[model samples]
Target: MTDAPVLPSHAYVPGHTARHTEGAFDPIRASVREGMSSKELARTEAFRAGLAFRASGHFWEAHEVLEPVWMACPPNSEPRAFVQAIIQLANAQLKLRMGKPRAATRLCQIALAHLDEVRGEVVLGCDVAALRVEVLALSTSSELQYNA
Candidate 1:
């Protein structure tokens, strides 16, 4: 998806009209930057804000917030992959909202690929294994409903 001209005050859901405007302040955009460890990144307000946005169905905002965390991690690192998986999941949800099941499924596949590199039960406050299962279901399910 293309970046919004400005951060919208309300969450965007495709096919549904919502008034969008500029001047919305985003903490992640204001403060998040590269050069942080996974652990440190997790502790940052920006990371928490990303999670909140994702949980609140603000998929685009979530992606915007989390991208910096992904970039901060070393290339090919588990932390980077994990963060990317989450971002992909958010994007997949956005695609689903846009009524593009094929695109959503494809995004889920990409998320799964990134998740495969992640180890352990948890990372950055998420259950990696559970997330993998959920993404797999989304990738294969006939009904493309995004349940958060």
Candidate 2:
């Protein structure tokens, strides 16, 4: 295991952050309107925060923050699939942290499947090709390391 990255004050990581006992961070307090454009959705604070949480090893919080953005996207659209892939990635990491390697591998496979639905090389700020490679590696790794 490696040291966790420094996260924003408002970011909450379950078991690691004291603030989680009070309440999980809710980046989306209300339902997001459906049919929002991918560019517009990508610009939202929730999306940015979600990515930040994931990068900081706060996988649970990242999934919580990104779910609304995923819900807001048009069904079957590349943006929806992209967000779903990210959410699955977060879940995969969380499962790894929980010592559930089988679950993590399954989730990584699901994430890769979702990635296939995306049409662009990049979605939002994520490099789709790079993400695919990362997820595939995670799925096959026998000994994975994670941050706190």
* Winner by TM-score: 1
Top-scoring candidate (lDDT): 1
Candidate 1 C-alpha lDDT tens digits along 1-148: 1232333467877567563345243545555567877778877766777777887788877887787788787898888899899999999988987888878988998999999898867887778998888788878676664532
Q: Model 2: clashing residue pairs?
A: none
Q: Report backbone clashes per prediction.
A: 0, 0
Candidate 2 lDDT, tens digit per residue, 51-88? Answer: 87887887887887788899898889888898999899
TM-score of 1: 0.80
Q: Model 1 segments beyond 4 Å from truth? A: 1-9, 18-26, 145-148
Q: What clash pairs does model 1 have?
A: none
